[model samples]
Target: MINRILVVCTGNICRSPTAAHLLREALLGCDIAIGSAGLGALIGQPIDGAALATLECHGHRPQLHRARQLTAELAQEADLILTMEQGQVQGVIQRIPEVRGKIFLLGKWQGELEIPDPYRQGPEAFEHSYGLIERAVASWAGRLLLRR
Candidate 1:
C-alpha cells in the first residue's frame, strides 16, 4: 500500500537523485511514485554532472529533477522516506514527527553505512557514492517488493 516514496540526502544534487532513479527502475511493478530531496538543500539545482555519468553507466537515464526544501507537508505526504544518514532521519523526524516509523537509512537495510555526499570531491568520489546509492536502493526495493 506504499504509494509514494521520498529519498533524501544533503544537497539533493547527487545521492538522492541516483537512489530515486534506481528505485524507479528496479521497482517498476510497484504503484509507488519515487522522489528525492535535500535537508540543507541547494533548491532548484539539477543533478550533478558526475552523478548523471555514473547513472548512465548503470543503464539508468534519469529525468529532470530540481532540489526542493524539506517541509512537514512533504514528509507527511510520502508513504516512506529514505535518507542518506542518521542525522537526516533525526532532522526529518524532529520537524515532522508523523514520519517516524517510515523513515530509514538507505544504507542500513543494505547492510552498509551512510552514503556520504561527494559534492566537490571529484569524479572518483561521485563514482563511489553512486555505487553505494545503487546498491542501497536495489536492496531496499527488493525488500519492499517482497513485503507487498
Candidate 2:
C-alpha cells in the first residue's frame, strides 16, 4: 500500500505545495502522509500569494507552507511521487534513478495532464492551475482510496 506521497514541481512555492495541500485534504483521515518539494525550489519561501488566495477561495486552509528543495532522501522516502509536469518526472528520475518506478505525473488519470506554473502570472493563471490541480488530486484520491 502507498503510505507516503510527494508532489513535485519546478518551484515549491506554487504547483507542488498547492497539489500537496489538496492531496492532504483529499486523503484526510487516511493513513497517508503527503508532502511537496521542488526541483529548483525557492527555499524558505512561502506559497505564492496568488496560489494561496486561490486555495483559500477553494476552501483549502493550507498551513504554514515553506518551500523545500527536492532531495534524494525525500524521493526515496515517498512510496509515490507525483510531478506537475512531464519534465519534472524526467528531472526527478534523472536525479534519483532508484525512484523511477514510483514517480508519475500528478495528472496521470486526467489524460496525463500537466499542471502549469503560475508564478507572477496573476490571479487567472493561478486559478487555472488550481482547477487542474484540484481535478488531478480528485482522480488520485479516488484511486488511492480504492487501494486503502
The superposed Cα distance between candidate 1 and the true structure at residue 120, in angstroms, equals 0.7
Q: Which stretches of candidate 1 lie over 4 Å from their true place?
A: none
Candidate 1 has its poorest 10 consecutive residues by lDDT at: 108-117
> Candidate 1 — which pairs collide?
none
Question: Model 1 shows how many backbone clashes?
Answer: 0
- List the global CA lDDT of all models: 0.87, 0.93
Q: Which stretches of candidate 2 lie over 4 Å from their true place?
A: none
State TM-scores per candidate: 0.94, 0.98
Model 2 Cα lDDT, one tens digit per residue, 8-94: 998799999999999999999997999999999999999988899999998878989999999999999999999989999999989
